[model samples]
Target: MAEKGRPRAFDRAAALRRAMVTFWELGYEGTKLTDLTAAMGINSASLYNTFGSKERLYREAVALYDRTAGSATNRALRGAPTARAAVEAMLRGNVDTFADPETPSGCMIVLSATNCSHQNRKVAEHLAEWRRTSVAELEKRLERAVEEGELEPGTDVAAIAAFYATILHGLSIEARDGVPLERLRSTVDHAVALWDSLVRQPAGRG
Candidate 1:
């Protein structure tokens, strides 16, 4: 029998990061196989053997993003002392992240599969599900805020979460379209200020 091919030696973690950045910049369908190989500093055969397939690699890359960007988002929501403060921090933090000089603009999840061919429809659906998860998390946080009396007892927490989610996703698109960081920050400030009108602070409180 013929001898089996030998496994290639490489840093898997480092290679995955390079692939993640490629997908972050180019998206699922836009990212070419050659681009992944070039950025990863590996041959095509090596890449396929190591990553199994492009779709699988994309999923892994998104998971990496969840650990980094998604974790930071959750922190911004949960770390603050109040619901409004948490959302303010989350939105403001998104502005900073999308505008950071060190990485591609916009979000990987939002930009990665905005539009894809039918063959890649699954990828787009996968990203949409991730967005839904985010919306659900925000809804839960807002619901808790209602229970804690930070928001009006009759507040429609789900609707509030959807409103913020829409704004956050719009910010991602604007970042990708070259909207300036300062402008985005101004928008975030305005959005946060809306909380004053929405929340039901205790009597005699600001």
Candidate 2:
């Protein structure tokens, strides 16, 4: 059923990127197949052939978003000079981007989970798994800080990581609600200060 001379050269990555923005703007339930096909610049059969189904395509789009945006937090956490700096960078970067008025779409995971029913369980599970991985990664970094004497040996790394992770979810919600960048920055600042206070000082300090 191929068109006479129309070549079949769909850019899979580019299509997924477009799909990501569409889904980010319109939640799972709100986005129709027609909307997705138009956004992706493909026909129904082509879209289905390329991505399998709407649900499958949505999952791929979420995965793409996760790799681009969510992975930035992971990279920041791993690249910073200190554990505190890493955590601060991760939290601050997320809020800064999420609160940007220039960002055409809101937080995809947050919007999807709130608007979609259990039919979108795969998307929900993907987001949940990403959060769990983030928290665990932070906990490991905190543990490393303790071993390096940057944090108290008795510090509850798991608890602190969980606390910060919860704060991140709140920030995502705030961003979705269109909170101002300054307010989001202030919130992150307060959270960073609280985190700083928990650092373990060197022994025999004044």
Candidate 3:
């Protein structure tokens, strides 16, 4: 043969998972190239050849987090019987995630790349889009609730969704700040308790 490329040596899936955890813990700009290589158990050349660039690898890590860590919220939203129940389940899932000993505390999408600098502002915007999408999901669920008569016709779906999304994003910061799981659960309970008033009919409206 005139030439043959060498076979790849590492487990790519396993390596990507490790890289995801590294980025989850250290964030985008805070993570050095050496950090990725070390955590991934791969060399610099392999990192470049496989992942293309640090930013690309970071993007993949965030996507992986959305697929994995975010499963809890997705499951809760999909499985609960009522919109109110779904909201509680989603918030409670955050408490469980924050307390989980195996993974980094707080949400990866909310925490990992949010404060990127002007030179890397796109990374921050990427995460902001994810937060926006989450609010949309909540709004969609609430709309279904209103259509099904579980909520009043006058319910402010957008406001309710945006409010819960704010609490969801805030939980990430609180957990990252080292708040205890018990305290986090209490915060979620307080938010959950507000749903009745939030969706209630105003004054003379139905």
Which candidate wins on lDDT? 3
Supply every candidate's count of residue pairs whose N, Cα or C atoms clash at under 3 angstroms.
0, 0, 0
| lDDT measured at residue 167 in model 3 versus the true structure, 0 to 100 | 93
Which lDDT value does model 2 have at 106? 43
Reference-based lDDT, each prediction: 0.85, 0.78, 0.86
* Model 3 bad stretches (over 4 Å): 1-8, 201-206
Q: Write the per-residue lDDT of candidate 2 for residues 1-206, one digit (tens) a residue.
A: 88897747788888889888888777777889999989888898888888899888888887787778656577777798788998899888888767766554346765565644777776677767766887899999988988988787777787778778888888888888878878888999999998865554333331
What is the full ranking by lDDT, best candidate first? 3, 1, 2
lDDT of 1 by residue, 111-135 (tens): 8998999988999999999899988
TM-score of 2: 0.86
Model 3, clash count?
A: 0
Q: Which ten residues in a row are the worst by lDDT in model 3?
A: 197-206
Predictions: Cα RMSD each: 4.2, 4.1, 2.9
Model 1 has an lDDT value of 0.85
- In model 2, where do residues sit more than 4 Å from their true spots? 1-7, 199-206
Give me the displacement of residue 118 in model 1, in angstroms.
Answer: 1.0
Winner on TM-score between 2 and 3 is 3
The TM-score-based order of candidates, best leading, equals: 3, 1, 2
